[model samples]
Target: MPVARSTKAQSIKQPRAGKAPSVTENVPPEKEEGCQAKRSPSSPQGGPKKRSAFGDITNAHKNQAVTGKKEGVKAPTRKATRPPPALVVAKNNEINLKKSLRKTPPTDVPVEPEKDSVSEEPVQQVPVVEDIDKEQLGDPYASAEYAKEIFDYMREREEKFLLPDYMEKQPDISRDMRAILVDWMVEVQENFELNHETLYLAVKLVDHYLVEVVSMRDKLQLIGSTAVLIASKFEERCPPCVDDFLYICDDAYKREELIAMETSILRTLNFDINIPIPYRFLRRFAKCARASMETLTLARFLCEMTLQEYDYARERPSKLAASSLLLALTMKNLGGWTPTLEYYSGYCAQDLHPLVKRLNFLLTYQPCDKLKAVRTKYSHRVFFEVAKTTPMDMMKLEEKLKS
Candidate 1:
């Protein structure tokens, strides 16, 4: 991919504070397998029954699925009383993870906060953010009406799949071992031409399973492979078969063992595979900011690094994404947080500082040998060679914080 030049954001209208989120969260549309109708045979002999390369392992239960369009969520007009809407959780158990952004006290620039507080914060309103979906009225891929609602539901679901420092529970395996496994999984993703989501979800599966079950060092690869197998089922159009994964392992694990492990992971996690991933959030946040492809790729490179580190295992995916984009903007000489980004992302530039500083540190320095998967991957021309971009100075980060 050609390197994307940095682009200035369009002027943001004054941001009015959002009201309590009242959206009815909708899940993303399910992907349907495209079936090609077979031509009627010349005689009474029937054509072969439809089967998949992977035996439709992704849809073993949905072989006879109907082909019907899902109902789309309807968009609402801007309300006179309400500014832009916040993504409030519809479920009682769901907790808000996106903290309202605290203004980063500026050192050089005097950027104003979105809203001024006169006891209840009554000041000026430029243009309140209309629904983000309004611009793409008829785009099915964008899901314009329910995009925010869908992401809100994802934040709520993040709570259920949160992981503690699972390395403490593994007697035979250490963080280093897990790091190596993730590095290898990155290689697998590259080899298989898998989607980025597949890699992320596979890592999530591994962490979640390790939380519930103890395993030997040798079987760790087995667990990782099975997690990838399961993630592929969810994220890929045509995922690799059992044999493909087994072959990658050099026959270290048996087909039955891989299948058995898949059963265990699903049971342990209660079959809830719709876990929120940072990659999806990064894309959304980058779009909201109107960042350049290079800037977005840089942010992606930062976010991908966290996969190798056990420290960020429990960090909220939304927060990680917001932070990564914030740092990327700053790095590219783009202005700090804008009202539109703050409103849509539910985070201020300051809210991202802790992660921004840490991610900047990782980018500034050379990663250790085992954890170089992300850096090397991004170094290639297709990724805009973002890994080669200069890192922000830690001193500069401190100066920003002190302000």
Candidate 2:
């Protein structure tokens, strides 16, 4: 105080923009109490304890009043601390409102505006297909098992359903030549990783076309190649080219020769591209059995394996498909064939003798050791369940196929 010698005098600092005047310099210490007294509330310990804005007394205020009463006043026994009626109703209303809000859609959600200029378009409905009544259809396979009955039934059915102008054809190759052709074709089909239907149809085509048309000896391999090419085209989404067919034949047949043979076969068949393949039969039979897809696929692989065999390829497609599916179910340890399956498939004991015999023989025999070798070479999973059969049983089947 003697000489509070210019404490901040030397530094002539400018005040900042929009700054309030410093309280320390503008108001003296003597004026501080006067400002506080003027600002003081009429009552001190906050407002009186009553209902809150939402109409509920705070518990803390209630507790303090009870504790602060006269010492002997029996601690002002607390009443049941229920919320006021108004507050309870308000809370219930809030809950109900929240629930309704959840149920109601948002008001600001975007809606498509109707176009006044556009006319309403009429919808064209498609006609639904009616289910074919099985009772009216009788048995499609009535002739399948009982030879005489099926023969007569098929004759009538053929006359009723088949085209009258259909040409008759049969396989012309000698048994041994046909067998050799079948074996070669089987090998080629397996090499290509092709569907059994393709090979089966190819074999059928070779047999059918040879029966009807007189082809050159030089064109025999070409016939096989062309049949395979056409069958592949029908069966495979990504069919091999004509050059690929030539390559499969080790270039024994020229590319032009294969193409010419393919054209001839296509013409001979009258471009009636529909071939009744075994896979469809297999699927239908599998469905009837309620066999799983994996079982069906494995059975299909087995069926395809049979397509390579000359004897097996000659069997009816239905028999082939049924036997494959049945054997697959057996291999997978899925036992118990249902009556529905039997009735639907027409695979009763009386009907299934030939098919069962073939299937039993196939399941029991068939020297798949070579197939195992190929499967192992490629590490293919097709033979994953091959051991589901036995060598001793397989030998027995071998002996039976011979018989």
Candidate 3:
């Protein structure tokens, strides 16, 4: 019984030694040194041919060399590697399909009507003559010459009611000086990016009010500036302050004086403030006549020249506008002002025949030497006036004004 037990123990020990040889041969290079110190090599093929449990190729053969047991080792053999041709063909087909899809045509969709339509309605005609009376149309003020009569009456009033007293009072500044001031003020307004209409209306208001309100005893410059201040506030969103107004005037007037003048001017005009200025009319008519800037400037000078004439007090704003435009047309050599423009003027004022006749008379009327006294005596506010020394070229003006 003791001998049988000894043989069983030896059998177990023999197999254990053989297993150690195989494990040492298959160990990786990293583990070979430690593994060799504990076990001997079995066979070289043991490292190369042995398949791991996970079937991965590792440094098993390298370990055999490190252990000095590589003479019997064989190189690792792997299954032949190839991708299936069907898979490659399917990938190419997918790419071609994407390319062909990009070029496919889009479908057109049909649109439906949004709403149903209703039946058409018949036209209606209303009478205008029945509403207006014939007697009203035939009144003297309603006649074609009504506008001319109004202008004539205004001229008479200006000469009779406005000019005599104005002429009697001694002028503080010469006509030439006033004209220079006017020109300079215009330049300043433009430089300051101020409203041209405000400046113009201010000038017009000063002229209109001065004809009746203040005497030549009062400072005209103060009146002009006062008008400008009032006009600026009325026409501009941001009017220049009183200091700025005085600064532009070279501090000629006090701050209190300007404010006082402004109040006085407003009161004189009855606070109506909506005085129609020649500058506004000039631009409108210049556009209508399609006149160039030079022509416009000359016409404006002529219109402004009228402000110095006391005779314009009674002159209708429209007549002044029409006459200035016609005179400018003559100066510019533009033959025959547009009838359409005339019609437009008539339409704007709600009266046509007066402007049409005014345009005709202004085009045909000849200026005479008899008016030289009138021209020389009248104080023009826009250009330099010379001393009474020589006669004007009435002949040239006559020929031009006639045409």
TM-score of every candidate: 0.68, 0.48, 0.43
TM-score of 2: 0.48
Q: How would you encode candidate 1's per-residue C-alpha lDDT over 159-242 as one tens digit per residue?
A: 887788777778999988888999999999999999999999999999988998999999999999999999999999999999
Clashes of 3: 0
**What shift in Å separates residue 270 of candidate 1 from its native position after superposition?**
0.9
Highest lDDT, which number? 1
Decoy 1 TM-score against native: 0.68
lDDT: worst 10-residue window of model 1: 64-73
Candidate 3, 1-403: lDDT as tens digits: 9999987676544333322244434344554443343232232222222222112212332243334322222223321132222233334434543454355332110000111111111111211112112334557755533533543444343333222334334355444444544555565566566766786677667665665663453477677767777888889999878888788778888988888888878787778766655566566567666677666765655565454344453465655666666655654567544554555344332243344344334324423332332234223333233212132244543465545
Candidate 1: where is the Cα deviation over 4 Å? 1-130, 400-403
Return the number of clashes found in candidate 2: 2
lDDT of 2 by residue, 209-279 (tens): 77558655566777887898898999898888777788878889787778777788888778765555567
Higher-TM-score candidate among 2 and 3?
2
Best by TM-score: 1
Candidate 3, poorest ten consecutive residues by summed lDDT: 107-116
lDDT ranking, high to low: 1, 2, 3
